[model samples]
Target: MRVRNKPWADDLITENPQAIVLNPEHYRGQWQSRFKSVQPLHVEIGTGKGQFLIGMAVAHPEFNFVGIELQKSVLAAALKQSLPAELPNLQWVLADGQGVNDFFEPREVTQLYLNFSDPWPKTRHEKRRLTYKSFLKSYAEVLGDGGQLQFKTDNRHLFEYSIMSMTSFGLNLTELSLDLHADVAASQGELENIETEYEQKFAAKGQPIYRLVAQFPKK
Candidate 1:
């Protein structure tokens, strides 16, 4: 479900320098300077076509938002939607999640979002999972004090694995819901919920979205 090779994609991303960062590696620690004010920074990794990031930026104007996507063609589609919104506090970057530490300074980001991330549902490929201990270490290096990672997925096995991973890694889970739509009491009151493209698609087909927020406490 990804367009890997689109000739026009790079050009669109390059042309919209105001909204998207064509050279994200150079901006590593200078992420905050690109935004209007020095607000708490929130980042979404694997921002596919960007429905979630765009909705988050529009809803919470107080926080600075960054959307990072690996695919140029996919990011191009995201840029197409965000540019016309004309949001000052929103920015996009082309990046791979595996290299988050290289992209930002220590404790640079205040919040992280993982919306419908790839489950990587194989025993040998467990390291590729976003919530893996190795990935959590990378996240801890960049996430600032009191920072937390919010996650949502439709995969039950992945969700269970994530919960176990968080516990073993000494990361605390603040909230969790195995069935976001159906489990009324477990979801607790309405969370400031924003639907990602995958969430919407799965929910329409009667699939329950699993969600959790985890953080590492300062010792």
Candidate 2:
């Protein structure tokens, strides 16, 4: 999808000094020290409109967050929102999601968030889907052993496909829920605040948002 260029893009670029990693290669194998102290780093791939990534960073001050999006226009919007908040724990990267392993060393990421990622429903486009086996392998390389992947999507087909992919990749899947809100109400401490624009829309429509948490086995 082509992203519409926004006039504010230039301003966003200037405002987000810390968000832009001019030399990501320098931090390789030394990302832990970027935080005040060593803390778990969570990454959200394809963070559209920046709502969820920003909200999570605000909510979880103890954990560092890196949000990656390939579209410059979408990333600009996120950068604008993030700059005003001056969130110390959050950073944004404009890069292909598939290249995550190249940017971080092995076992560097503690958790990953994949919220309402592209369904890529066509069989021919399965490889482009973020939950495809190839992408899972990339995530595994950066994620620590036993690190968790939290995924939520409104598309049932994509959710099912993701579950299959996770299992095929030898991940231990748990906390599967077809309806997140209903499941959350039934189980205390199960609900987290809605962070993404799609999530809010889905909730307004009373849609059943499927969610799952998968953990990589210790190697």
Every model's Cα RMSD, please?
1.9, 1.7
For residues 65-152, write the lDDT of model 1, one tens digit per residue. Answer: 9898988888888998888889988998887878888888888899999989999888999989999999888888899556799999
Alpha carbon lDDT of each predicted model:
0.87, 0.85
Compute each candidate's TM-score over C-alphas: 0.93, 0.92
lDDT of 1 at 130: 94
User: Clash totals for all models, in order?
Assistant: 0, 0
Q: Which ten residues in a row have the lowest lDDT in candidate 2?
A: 16-25
lDDT of 2 at 37: 50
**Model 1 ranges with Cα > 4 A deviation:** 1-4, 183-189
